[model samples]
Target: MRLGTRGPHNPSYVWRSLQSTKELIKKGARKRIGSGCQTKIWGDPWLPDQVNPCIESVCSQGLESSTVSSLRSAVDGSWDIDIIQDLFSERDQRLILSIPLSRQECDDNWMWANERFGVYSVKSGYNLQTNVSDTSPNSPSINWKFVWRLGIPAKVRNFIWRVLSSCLPTMQAFLTLRVEVNNCCPICHNLPEDDFHALVSCPWARSVWNISSIGSYFNSSCTFADWWINITHRRNQNDVELATAILWCLWQNRNDVVWNGKCKSATAIFDSAQTLYSQWKMTRKLHSPQINTEQQTMQERWIKPPE
Candidate 1:
């Protein structure tokens, strides 16, 4: 159960798959201190804090191998405030003192930090994975409200969400996943095809944007998420919808270049976006239920005649 335990030299496929879960286990497991003899204060993750379950303070010269037991008083079996105050930083001292010890003697054990019952479950693991994916340090802060509220198709909104969240399978995304593929933009053959480059910075994409109505919103923002947020904040809902539609079409064109080796003119791309936007708007208008004011008034006046 230790973090450093290695797998067999020739492991089976099941064993390999099981070994892949070590990191997830390491992230969620912490030592539930009992006697504190078995848990190393500096090495083991015994702290209760979710942000950092392990000790953040540097180990003193002679305290490298010190156990949690050393910080406890011999007589009362409580935390030694004087030793903790001297040996650790203010934050570590506070954290160490906050953990309550068991009244009776017991052996130290590992517990799932995410669960109240100290047991691991598949649901908790899945949630941990999802949270990690969504809140990665490398990801930009996206205005999800703006994305989902845009007057565009649900699929297009989802597409924009993927782009903003760095979920799209761009060339750089493939590289990050260790997939062997050319990282250059398939459309422009210039920079590495990342979210920003694929959607905004590629020559083909830029051409389409330059000819579009919302081109003025494009600026020197580093990421597509930033650019989207900036433009949506300043522009109206119609402009946001147009911009989203154009980006979606541009992505389709890029895919055509990547998969079918076909590229469209900038005007063609822009026209496709406009067509898509207008058609969606018209479709919404047609499908939306229109209330007849006269009929509604008649019904209201004649309501509950018998019942």
Candidate 2:
């Protein structure tokens, strides 16, 4: 939604947005107790868990109207363990007991339990919208780190990330956005243009990968994301470098066909990839003596803004 004059909000849009927010809060949110007046003791997230900040209680036996303060010390602002044990199960009681109560006198607040500090922020709000489960070791960002850690240039890794996220100006992406563009592959026109077709399935893309270091590891029929993850996460350093370079070259070749009417052979694509791979490797060797192999990196990562 576009920002308007900072006066009144559109009622209909605001209501719909709040409804969606309520749904997310139900899934995760931690209520940090203060005065405990604003939160429902049994309803809102008042308990803490490691993976999730807030836990929900379904035992709505009789305490619908009670506030969290009803279970804590009104004089010293501490949680009463007996009260919690009486109302909740042993598991919940332990979880609720672990939360360190605040000492300063203030109003009760809804904190984003998923974050480091309990305070809410836009980044935390955006994170709540993702479907990717961090519980998996094979999660997208985790594998993406492997790609980024490869000796390739940061820009190429960034481009690959964009490609995986489907942010490239692929023909199918335009068509999906109702941009009135043809969906056929811009390079080959053999299949509908998408990340997979443009980078892997097209006749030219297949030719490039056939002779590269990643030769025959993936076929044209493999899904782009699955193949990408398999390469970056599973393959060795040399193969990872070759795969990244080939995909980058393929994308550039696609652009050439789209804008410059220049189509390169598979051999030419392979040469381009190899040249880039060598250059990046040599550059890294010349500049950095020791490699920084930490999961966190100095390389800038792209994150989509909040919708």
- The per-prediction tally of clashing pairs is 0, 0
Clashing pairs for predicted structure model 1, backbone only: none
Model 1 per-residue lDDT at 249: 91
Per-prediction RMSD in angstroms? 6.2, 11.2
The list of candidate 1 runs beyond 4 A from truth reads 1-38, 48-53, 56-58, 69-86, 104-141, 176-178, 216-221, 282-307
TM, every model: 0.67, 0.67
* Local accuracy by lDDT, each model: 0.84, 0.72
Q: How many clashes does the backbone of model 1 have?
A: 0
lDDT of 2 by residue, 77-157 (tens): 798877777777777777878777778767876666667776667767656644434445654443545655777777887
Minimum summed lDDT over a 10-residue window in model 2 is located at: 1-10
